[model samples]
Each structure stands twice: as C-alpha cells, then as structure tokens.
Target: MPDRNSALRGQRIHGQFGNISKEPGVTFREIKDFSYLEITLWDWARDSLRSKLAELLGIGDLPDTGDSQRLKEGRLLHLADGSLAYLGAAAPADILEVAITPEEGCVVPLGHARCLLRLEGPKAVALLRRGIREDLRDTAFAVGQVMTTDIGGIGVLLLRPDTAKFDLLVPRSHAIEVWRWLTRRAAPFGYEVL
Candidate 1:
C-alpha cells in the first residue's frame, strides 16, 4: 500500500506561487490550486457537446454574449471553438472526464500546460494598462468579459470577472516572464503578492 504520508500522485505536476505578501494594494498571485480543463468540441459536435457538459457540470445555459461566465464565483471560459472550466482544488480532471467522451469533444488537461494568474485591487487595471494597448475602461471591459490579447508582448487570455480584478492565462513557458513584467509595471503603485 502507498504510504499515507507521502505526497499524492499529480501533486508535483501542479504549479506553485511562493511567498506572496498579504499587505494589500494590487494583490496578484499565480493560481496554483485549481483544476483546469479545456473542452474542444468538433465543429459538428458543438451544440450537443455543450448541452452534455452543461448538464454534467451543473452550469446553466452557457453565456451567449461574452466569452466567459462567472459560475458560482469560478468561471466557464468560452473560446472560439471550445471552452475551458475552472474547478475547485480537490476536483480532478478524471472526474470531469467521466461525463465526457471522444465523440462529443476532447478534454485537455491544462494543469501543467498553462498558468493562471489573478490580479485584484484598486490598481489592477492601471497595472494592466501599462502593458496592453486595448481600452480597458470599466465601461469597455466589464465583468464577465474575456478577450485574447497581448500583454507585455505575450499573447494571453484576459478575463475580467470583477470590476477591480483581472485573470490572465498564458502558456506555462511564458508565465514567469509575464509575472516579472507585471510586478515591474505594478511597482509604481504599492503591490503585494497574495
């Protein structure tokens, strides 16, 4: 039998956000505690696949206006040809896959393939404006809106689920560079890693 005290399988595959201060200001951190899954539906399978996923995940009808929906505080990320969902820390891809099949869509595990970072607080928008050229005014990019744009020259999926917050998703390879760029730009205003 496996040692009960030993680290569980897949534990090390998860990312880490070390030593973030709680001091306040623009608090940012890599979200290392959630499960990420991407559901890519084949062209002809889109409608049926979405219905099945909606039923299984208990996510009521998907959003039609924006590319994301705040479901129970988390989110269901819609893409041009697929969708991504964020689950609780204890939720595993296997559990998500149980309700899915190859005929409908493909379930991609993004836990190690991508990194999600969350920025929130008073200066969050300003901090992001330093890098992205898009108009980020509250009226322009309201909560529950998601757009794919370049930040610090890196292509990223930006989601605004709250007025004072933003979530950025980038490839794992570019996460560190993006984090560095964010902190450097945020330095003008007081910031704390959370």
Candidate 2:
C-alpha cells in the first residue's frame, strides 16, 4: 500500500475517501453513505427468490428478469447474471442472520471487501468515456441502471442510481489505481477532491 499521507501532499485530497462532496466541478470520493450487501441465491432457487430477498431488505419488488440491466435507486438491483445487490437507505441486519439459512441465499457486506467511488457532475458521463466503451447515453444506460464492467482493466460495478451521478464499486486492492485513473481522466474536466 502506498503512503496516502505522502502521496497526497500539496493536493486537496484526504486518506481513504477523498474530500466528500466538498470541492467544485466533478466530485470524486469513496462512497461512505450507504450500506452495500451482496446476496447470492442458490441454484435451485426460483425467480421469486429475488423478490423474497428484496422484501427481506425492504427495497420493494425486483426489476423483471428481462430488464436485468436496470437498477433502481433505493431498491433492489438485479445483476445480469441473476444475482442481487441492495443499494437501500439503511444499514442491513447482522450478516450471520441474513446468511444463516443457506437454502435462501447469503448476504455479504461489501464495505470491507470493496470500496465504492461516486462521481457526479455535468461531465460525469464524458469522464467515464475515457476508460469505458459502453453506450452511456440516457436512452441506453438510464438512471437506476447498473452494469458490471471493466474500467481501466479493473472490474467495477457501475451504477447510475441518480442523474448525472455514477457509483463505481472497485476492489480494495485496485481502488488506488482506479482512483488515479479516474482523476487523470477528469483533469481536463476540472475535477476536485470532493
């Protein structure tokens, strides 16, 4: 791990999560607001299992399987592969309880294993083009949509839960590298620590 203290000298940056929604221009910061939980169902589980998980999490109905690419804000997000992730408002209950019954599925907290960065601004979509090749137009990747793709060769879960805002879930090991890539890409757009 690089020395965050030494690496951030003279820069308007903070350790772990950069300035949280403080600076002007595009805001880049590790997301610390919501609780992320990964729920994986068993192979024998039916499609209703997805909704059951949602009800458990209190996010409401799951998007239809055909619309797997769409993600709803403060709702249950169904991944392309049938898995589900919760991007709800409140923190989840004990992981052990959620995962106690293996027949249903398991709830795994991603805070420690993964770090999510939120970038929001008018130029947010443009910045994403630097490393992503997906069609990000509002028509295709509309708000409340999530996609698992590679950014700068790093696997990331890109979520457009809000207008002009993108949440990137990157592995902790690659957080620094991805952050550097994002900052470099946003330089011309006048990015800030926040």
Candidate 3:
C-alpha cells in the first residue's frame, strides 16, 4: 500500500483563516471554534433572508427545504425559527452582533467550539466510513445530508456536501488525532493526506 501522506502529495488546500496550510494541490483551512449567532425572521420572510444570505456569501439561493450548500468561502447561516435566523462563522477577534427585534424571536451568540476536517479526493468516502457509524452508502446518506454521529469514538458533525468529498466537525482538541487516523485508514486505498 502507498504511504498515506504520499497519496495526498499534490493537492490545493482550502480551509478557514487560522488553519490554512500549503499543500501541493490541497488546501487546509482552519475553521474551527466559530461563534454561533441566532437570528429570527418574520413570517414568510425566510426565503428573503435566505436569499440575502446567499447573496452576501456569494452562493446560490437556499432551497425551501433540506440543507444549504456548504459555504465554500463564508460561514453557514442557519435560521431555526420563522422570523429567526442562526449565523455561525469563524471570526478573528471580537464577536459580531446583528440587531433584530423581540417579536422576531432571538439572536443568541454561542461561544467557540468544534473543529472542522475536510477530506477531498476520490477515495474520501471509502476512507471516512472506516471510523464513522452512519451509513455512507449513496442511497442512504446522499449528498447534503448533515448528521451528528460518532467517528472513531469521537462526536462528529458529518456533512456530505458533495460526492467524493466530506466535511467533518469534531472537538478542536482531537483534530490532530482524527487527521492521523484518517490518513492511516486511507492508506490501503491510496489515501493522501493533503
């Protein structure tokens, strides 16, 4: 079997601000520990809000139901209630606040937590399943399904934003170990550690 690191020999890295790294053809951005903010919208205004969010983030409008596309360049804005919204992003320093109204529910700010691990490659799916419990079969966990499950005995937020790729969320402290595990598991299949 090829060495895990060798497989990821040349790939561009794409990740958040802090964890950015230079890989051949891989990009690793550190988007862990983002502040969570909740916003409430008025009735029948969710679509408008979604539109505004997409525009602000440079992505397509969100669908009426199901999950939103993973913000490739920005943070995820999740609206939990009608007349309410939730925003979470990785900020450098002070937390950002957006004012809404009492009748519009609430916009609560959550503290820093969670680590993000993105694996991109043809063999990514096969490698990820080695440590995760959720069924990764195409028919079962289709792309865009966000699931909270355990991976290698660790809690993880698994998102299959697209085929041949995955975004994993875990506690920040275990990021390295998880990466190592993923690298090691992917070896047999020519897994690369980008």
TM-score winner: 1
Tens digit of per-residue lDDT, candidate 3, span 67-154: 4355543345332335222224444112223334445335555333445567776656777777877788888877766566777777
lDDT of 3: 0.51
**Predicted candidate 2 versus true structure: per-residue lDDT over 4-93, tens digit per residue:** 222223433843232335444577766555556676777677466755655665555666531322323354567745566765444343
> How close is every model to the real structure, measured as TM-score?
0.77, 0.76, 0.55
Regarding TM-score, does 2 or 3 come out ahead? Answer: 2
Q: lDDT scores for all predictions?
A: 0.69, 0.66, 0.51
Best by lDDT: 1
Query: What's the number of clashes in each of the models?
Result: 0, 2, 22
Which candidate do you rate higher for lDDT, 1 or 3?
A: 1
Worst 10 residues of 2 by lDDT: 1-10
Question: Runs in model 1 with CA error above 4 Å?
Answer: 1-24, 83-93
lDDT (tens digit, per residue) of candidate 1 on 62-143 = 6654467655435677766565555334353556666667886678766666677889988789889888998899888888
What is the Cα-based TM-score of model 1?
A: 0.77
